[model samples]
Target: MPIVYSEKEASLQEVVTIQEVDDLLEWLLANTDASIDLAECRHLHLAALQTLASARRKVSAWPQDEAFKGWIKPLLTTGE
Candidate 1:
């Protein structure tokens, strides 16, 4: 399942699987007020992360897992 983060009455869904990224991206483009939250997820495929990173989307929080954090660190804190 994807992780969704809401801030300031806006919500963003972050997809970590290749299968769902496309759909999520479509949704995101249509709705720019939402925010993505990847901090609670685990086992996100690299390709999915890459797509979000390339788009420069910012995540609301960091995952608690160190490995997961390391993997997504670049994408999250880059202010993207």
Candidate 2:
């Protein structure tokens, strides 16, 4: 799974694709206080990006990939 879910945390890693978006959204909704970790994330499908953008969850860690971090951080933090 691109998203590794725990009791109160979700770590997005590898290439998160469209297939993972539904489950990712579900998990975020279910775990209302959970934070996300994206340090190991390599890529994100637009759907996944949208999910993250709208969910408004706390990000525990930013992606290690500079390009990806640059692209996604603003979108995720826009509402904060």
Candidate 3:
């Protein structure tokens, strides 16, 4: 699965396509202080990004892919 929910870490591992925005949103809403691990993420859908952006959650680990990191970095830091 692309989005792996970890109860112990209170984190979500974004590995591939985070296609279901509503599911992600629901998860985010349920889990406060949820951090995201994008170390192995290949693609993040726009809606998923929107959910993350709106939630303003912490990023526990960044993606290994530089381009993806570059793209998401601004969204993560701009409001802070």
The number of the candidate with the highest TM-score is 2
RMSD of each: 3.6, 1.2, 2.5
Model 1, residue 56: C-alpha shift (Å): 1.2
lDDT of 1 at 52: 62
Better of 1 and 3 by TM-score: 3
Q: Where does candidate 1 stray beyond 4 Å?
A: 3-15
Better model by TM-score: candidate 1 vs candidate 2: 2
Top-scoring candidate (lDDT): 2
Lowest lDDT block of 10, candidate 2: 71-80
Q: Residues 1-80, candidate 3, lDDT per residue (tens digit)?
A: 67777642333345444466777788788887667777777678887887888888778777788998999877865353
* Residue 4 CA displacement from its true place in model 1, Å: 4.5
1-80 in candidate 1: lDDT tens per residue? 46443332223233366777676666667666655665556666777666666656666666777886886786656553
TM-score of each: 0.68, 0.93, 0.80
TM-score of 1: 0.68
Cα-based lDDT at residue 73, candidate 1 = 82
Q: Flag clash pairs in model 1.
A: 57-80, 58-80
Clashes per model (N, Cα, C within 3 A): 2, 0, 0
Local error of candidate 1 at 68, Å? 1.3
